[model samples]
Target chain A: ELVLTADMLVEGVHVPRHVAPADFAYKALAVNVSDLVAKGADPTLYLLTLCLPKHPEPGWLEAFTSGLSNAQADFGCSLAGGDTVSAEGPVCLSITAAGTLPAGKMIHRFSANPDDKVFVTGTIGDAAAGLALIRKEVSAHPLSGEGAMREFLLSRYFRPHPPVAAIELLRQYASAAMDISDGLVLDFTRLCAASGCGGIIEADRVPLSPAVSALLEGDAFSLEAALTGGDDYEVLFTAAPGVADAIRSAAESRGLSLHCIGSIVREPGITVVGRDGAPMQISRPGYDHF
Target chain B: ELVLTADMLVEGVHVPRHVAPADFAYKALAVNVSDLVAKGADPTLYLLTLCLPKHPEPGWLEAFTSGLSNAQADFGCSLAGGDTVSAEGPVCLSITAAGTLPAGKMIHRFSANPDDKVFVTGTIGDAAAGLALIRKEVSAHPLSGEGAMREFLLSRYFRPHPPVAAIELLRQYASAAMDISDGLVLDFTRLCAASGCGGIIEADRVPLSPAVSALLEGDAFSLEAALTGGDDYEVLFTAAPGVADAIRSAAESRGLSLHCIGSIVREPGITVVGRDGAPMQISRPGYDHF
Candidate 1:
């Protein structure tokens, strides 16, 4: 089946000013591949369009393509072809990625049933914490006293490992699926909206990496960002209770950790239960560019 | 076979400052669809990425999407999906279009052989002449004494009709093919390079629209620009002598006019035969963004 998606990263907007050229290139491809992973589609080919500066620095294109090639190898996709043009504006990259799934097997964000269990792959909020660290919004904290945890959070924001090998299990088990991009609350809310269902998620049960746990040990702001700061690129999916064992086995076979954080409900909106078992007040559910 | 291509139009680079937003949007999709036509690919789907200003003018998104929808209908393709982001830089649009051709029947830029008859579809240099007129490069040419010719050239620059219906015939008969987006001379040279061949063309035989002919009757600079100015988006193909009848039939059936302008040669470069049947010297063959 034809499943196509386009994603763009604009210089100074999506990427940081001090990002390495190689990292920029890798992000360009990785982000698009992440979309395919969410759909449980086998990555096939991609078309990259670079709107670059008039006079690029020496070796910039080489580094950029090197990163792209590295990601292509990493994700099992080929660079079919691309267009490069000199933009008198800031550098921007646009990629159109194509992938294929078995007929009638693509999981949709709107297919979740009220009784389905909601699960998210990998740790959440590490990227958000990492971004805070990079921005220097939060310096040293007693919670993240270890240097290793700090480095882990920082790296998580820069690169993510999407669970590509679990596509079979996901396709078989997931009643609904989507990638976490614009924050957990927002994206999950979107998922609920699409399925015409609602969910109740336990905040404490949301998967958190040691790095993120340490970084935001006591900061409510950090907690909020973790829930609403997006860019995680982790797979958020739902499955029926009968297939829980099979889903766990599939994820373990790929050496991945999947966490069950909530369940779809008959309610019309999402309700986040805090550690106290009461609905937590949310100021904003997600990020919006417009 | 999957065929994909990308094209970008950066504000102030691809479009003139005086162009309307609607025209800008139309040109963005038209240029990319043109590439698919040259490849004899059946239009299927396209993804659009718009790097727009943070605060767009009222009705900008509607106008832009309207433009995209119009082109989707105009080119017989679907807007599968896309990404949108705000860039502080100038407005830039990147479109990745995907099409399919019969298995193992797609034409290549490097497939032309020696003695292949080289032909270009439609009249050449009209877009270039139109652009010149828009830029006031040629204000009051005696040949284009009427306003109709001026309007024709301007319209040609703003919108191009890629011969999408000619794909079946092209796949059956064409050995090599490419679109003329970056001037006839330069793209043709690239085609020859890709095929490890050369070509010779009588300049007077290069089909020219009445508007272009009238606009460049007395100005060699204008004439040269018309020949090498690019943005013409016409398919250039090479076919064997036996396929000439088929080529004519293909064009007539599609209501398109194909012009035989040159022939592939064993020699390794291009030669432009003037009206006097002598090789003419060229200074700049085409525009290079780099």
Candidate 2:
């Protein structure tokens, strides 16, 4: 079966105008690959439609193509064809990716049962924190001012490495799946709604990187920000409780970290429990372009 | 076999800012369908990526979607899925169309033999004349103000009906084929370069609508403009001389008009001959976005 997904990135709306051309190109392809990965499909090819305001300066197109080539190699996909045209506004890029998996083997978003265990691959909220740092909405004092932690956070924001290796594990165990592009809580809520169920998130169990942990420990950032921030690009999925140990062992063998963050319930909405075992308040769900 | 093609259109660059939303939407899809038709494939599905500067006014989205829906019905293609986002500048649209044809039966642009005869579907230069009218670069006196001729020219510009019915004729008879988004001489030159041959076009044999003929008679437009103007959206193809009669009969049976305008030659470049049988000088080949 063929799986198709498209994503659009606009300057100033999705990324800052001063962003490195290579970084922008890499992320543009990576995000579409992330969607295919969530569907348990291997990306085959893609079409790139690029609209630029004017002729690029020397080295701009070279750097952009290099980044795109690197992404194609990393994701095991090739450029099939595309269109490039001049625009009268900011640069806009649209990539449509095609992938394939065995027939009837796709993981759907509405297949989770009420008792399914919710799982997420890798740490979340690091990219959101990285974006906040880039926007100067948060202080970098928690990272002791420009060390490995700061670099790690910034890399997460600029070049997201979505877990492409999780395809086999997901096809084997996940009953429902989606990628976390928007905030974890918001996207998870959507999954639950589609499945006609609710969920309970144990906030303490949500994974965090050392950088985000440091920010939280120093009271420089709140846990709510991590839960509500977008651009995670990690796989959020659900599976039967019986497959938890098997899934963990498989992830371990593959050098992937899997976390059991929550579970689906029969209720009609989501509830997030803090470490003290009380309901936590969420200011907003996720990113909304409109 | 699956056939894929993509195109991008930007506001203010491709069309005027005040262009009708419905026309814009219809043409966006039609242009992509034209590519499929040129390849002798039946369009099956498409993915759209739209970026807008702001939330549209109430009737804007409705009109745009209605036009897109109508085009889908006409072209026998459905929307698979897409992404819509906010842009910081002009509205940009990218459509990736997927089509299907029998394996090994697709027409190519690089297979024209030296003796093959070149043919084009429908009349040329009407869209260019319409664009000239829109830009106020040409007087409407030739069209005699707001009459059917005036409306016809504008319709050709805004709603290009690229010879969709010519697919069968091309697949059956064409040695080389491509759709003419650019002008005839320029696109034919590209085809010749790819096929490693040359072509000679008889200017008098080139087809034209009554409106463009009147413009030429009044000195408001030139035959050179018709030969070099872009946005014709007609199919340009080559076939062996032996199949010319068969191709014409087949096209006639299908109610599609095809005119033999030129012939491929052993030389390395193109030549245009006027009615007096003397070579004519061309100022420029076609439109170049960059």
Candidate 3:
């Protein structure tokens, strides 16, 4: 069987105007490859559609292709074919990735059962904090002024490491899965919605990186904002409680960590319990493009 | 197995700024489907990546999506998924289409032989002429003044009919194939290049719509432009002589036309034979984006 998906990145929207060309290309491929990971499909080939401005910077194409080569090497996919056209708009990149899976083994978002435990790969809110740091929207305290934590968050925002290695494990162990391109709260809810179930997320269990934790300790950012921030590119999934150890071991072997945030429920709505063990209201779940 | 391809449409490049929103959407989907048709694969799914300008017209999305729905029904492909983003520049659309072919049965452009005969589906230069007419670049006499002929040319430009019905016939007979998107002459030459052979094209045998013929007779459009005009969306293929009759009969049964315009040759370069049976020089073969 085959899995297909496409994601487009427009300058000033998905990538910052001042971002490095190579980083822009990396993010373009990363976002799409992340989708393949959710399906438990091995990333194989991709086509790139590039819309360029007239007389772009001399090194833009070279650097961009270099970045694409790097990601191609990282994700183990080849560049198949694509189209390039000149436009008067900001640079736009549309990458279509193809993944192959064994018959009857492709994972989906709608397979989660009511009693499945919700699990998330890697740290969730780091990319969200990374984005906020890049945009200067949060000045959260001495942490922003002191450690290399700011650079760590910025790196997450610019160059995400898509977890393609976890695909087979997820397909083998998980009941439902999807990549966290949108915020974790929204994407997890989307998975629940697809499976016709609900979730109760313990907000404290939502994993955060050391950088994010430091920022929170300095009162520079809030846990609520992290939960709703987008562009994480992590895999959010649910599986039976029996597979927890194997999921953790697989992620550990890859030099990454996994977290169990909460559990799937029989209800039709999500309840996000605060760190203080009380249910909290979320005004907005995640990003929406119109 | 799955076959994938992506093409981009940018304002003032692929489409005119004044074209209907629905028409633009149709063209975006049509171009990608054409590639799938050339591969002799059944287009089963497509992903649309749209970069829209800020503050687009109120009804634009509705009309655009309606056009997509119509084309989706016409092509028999469902919208699998996509991404939408706001751009600060011209509207850009990137569509990635997926087609499935039996294992080891997919057609290729590099498989033609020197003894094969080249054929093209439908009319070749009508869309190119349509583009010129739409841009007010051609003002050729009574033909341009005629109502039905003018609209015929314009329709070819805005809405292309991909040859989805003829895939089986082509795959069974043709050794190599590709869609004539960049113009018959250029795309045919590309096929020859890939197959490591040459071509001898008889100018008079080239297919043309009634509007194009009338334009040529009235000195409204040049035959050179007709030969090298792009955006035809016709399938160009090379088949051995033994199956020619079967191919022709199949096309007839489907209410479409086919023309044997040229033959692959042992030489290493293409020879464009004029109506007088002599070689002719092509100043500019087709469109090229740099």
Candidate 4:
């Protein structure tokens, strides 16, 4: 087959209006590309079905298209066809990307094994923190006059660097891998569900930016929020313990951080453990698109 | 790649609510499959993304999925993946059907010949009349019993039995072809535009169903409506004049109609002529998304 496609991105739901147009296009294509990446497919071609605001400024379109072009060039993909429509409400973009995988070699969500070391590429919770900071800046007081923290948070919320290359690399050794768009804990739960297994997650071992940590030091609930918040766009994979060293080496070779945050187990439910070994559960775990 | 993709069908756009949900899924997937058919791609997999009403009835979903399953089986495609979400307003369905094309041999839109004979695979105006009939039925009055006009219009409007097999067979000989989703005149004009040439279509040679003819006899504008109204998923192609007979013969062998609507001219614009060789123009020509 020559196509792999999916569409979905509603304004105010998948993204916010405050985001840069270029970032919107980048994240839009990235989400679709991540689906292809999860299947161990290389990006080949894409079509954009855009429901844009009427009378969009030319600069916005230029920025958006430039972002799309950059992502396309980076992944060696081409734009083939698409539809553009004027919408009266918030802008919506639905993209379908098609890629090729070796015949009979496509990876699915299922197929995991007990004792596989669960790994995550890149730091988590940045996007969630960024959104929080944006809320604070807009609704409350401006936070520190566009300093590093604000810029980092806004960038994370805007252009989520999709783990396309990392996913492609992990496809070779990992039994199951998916981008953490819908938060770590929830997505990990889904991965476990798909593979018919449970997981043993370590709370302290999970990476968090210092800014996120500084915002609420003792609020353990916030840690769960970071775990369950969507839009991180980092790759979470599972590999056998024997390959942990190799996974770390491989990820480092590509200038990516590979953290052994947890492990797969034979049980059928999630159990998150703090440093002292007691199980912990927090509310507001993740998003569900009902 | 093992994925097939397409775009969203918005309410008040793709179909009417009076139409059954079963037909909605069929039209959604069929139109997408028509694209693959034009590429000589074999349908094998599908993924659907739906933006639905707040509380869609089970009957609607069941009928929709049934229609999708039917199309998949007919085309030998599998339902591989999907995501569904509730929208704030109006229902939308995005379906991507994956199909394989011979390596490095996929057909594209920009490959028409200057001296090719133009052919359309089926009758064109039935779908437009079908939409008209649907509007009339809803606002005017329902005809008693399953009247012939009502049944005919309903079939054309709802289940647009696109000639996929005919398209598959014609792909071998046709230089450039595409499904006529946006009215005959407009779509044919697009073909000419893509091929970088002109066309002279004979108005008298344009096929119309008996119902359309009846509707047009007392109304000059109804003919224009039938000519330019959109959503006819028929194959339109151009080829060398020398191969026209063989093409017609091949179509006939498969129990399909091959209409010789006109000739691909050397000029640079689309022109339609009546029996008296007078220039023709129709109002409300084709569909524009924005």
Instruction: DockQ for candidate 3, please give it.
Output: 0.76
State the DockQ of every prediction. 0.84, 0.85, 0.76, 0.44
Native contacts matched by each model: 0.87, 0.92, 0.87, 0.27
Sort by lDDT, best first. Answer: 2, 3, 1, 4
**In terms of lDDT, which candidate is strongest?**
2
Ranking by TM-score: 2, 1, 3, 4
- C-alpha local distance difference test of each model: 0.82, 0.89, 0.87, 0.73
What shift in Å separates residue A73 of candidate 3 from its native position after superposition?
1.9
- CAPRI grade, predicted model 4: acceptable
**Number of the top TM-score candidate:** 2
Q: For residues A1-290, could you state the per-residue lDDT of candidate 1 as single tens digits?
A: 75787899887777787577787888788788888888989889898888888788888899888888888888899988878889666688899888899988888899999989999988888888877777888774645455877777776777666777767778889999998888999999999999999998899999988777766665623666788886788899999988888888878878888988999997789998987888988898776777
Could you tell me how far off, in angstroms, the CA of residue A121 lies in candidate 2 after the best superposition?
1.2
Score every model by TM-score.
0.96, 0.97, 0.93, 0.91
Docking class of 1: high
Off by over 4 Å in 4: A1-7, A53-60, A103-105, A137-146, A218-221, B1-5, B17-19, B137-146, B218-221
Which number leads on DockQ? 2
Higher-lDDT candidate among 2 and 3? Answer: 2
Candidate 1 C-alpha lDDT tens digits along B1-290:
87888887888788886466777877888888778877878889888898888898888878777867777788899887888898786788888888888788777899889999999888889888877777777774655456787778887888777777777778888999998988988988999989999998778888998877766675623656767887888888899978888788878878877888889998889987877788877778887888
Where's the lowest-lDDT run of ten residues in candidate 3 chain A?
A139-148
Candidate 1 clashing pairs, residues 3+ apart or interchain: A183-A230, B183-B230
Using DockQ, rank the candidates from best to worst.
2, 1, 3, 4
List runs of model 2 lying over 4 Å from the truth. B144-146
Per-candidate iRMS values, in order, are 1.0, 0.9, 1.1, 2.5
Candidate 3 Cα misplacement greater than 4 A, ranges: A139-141, A144-147, A242-246, A249-256, A281-283, B242-246
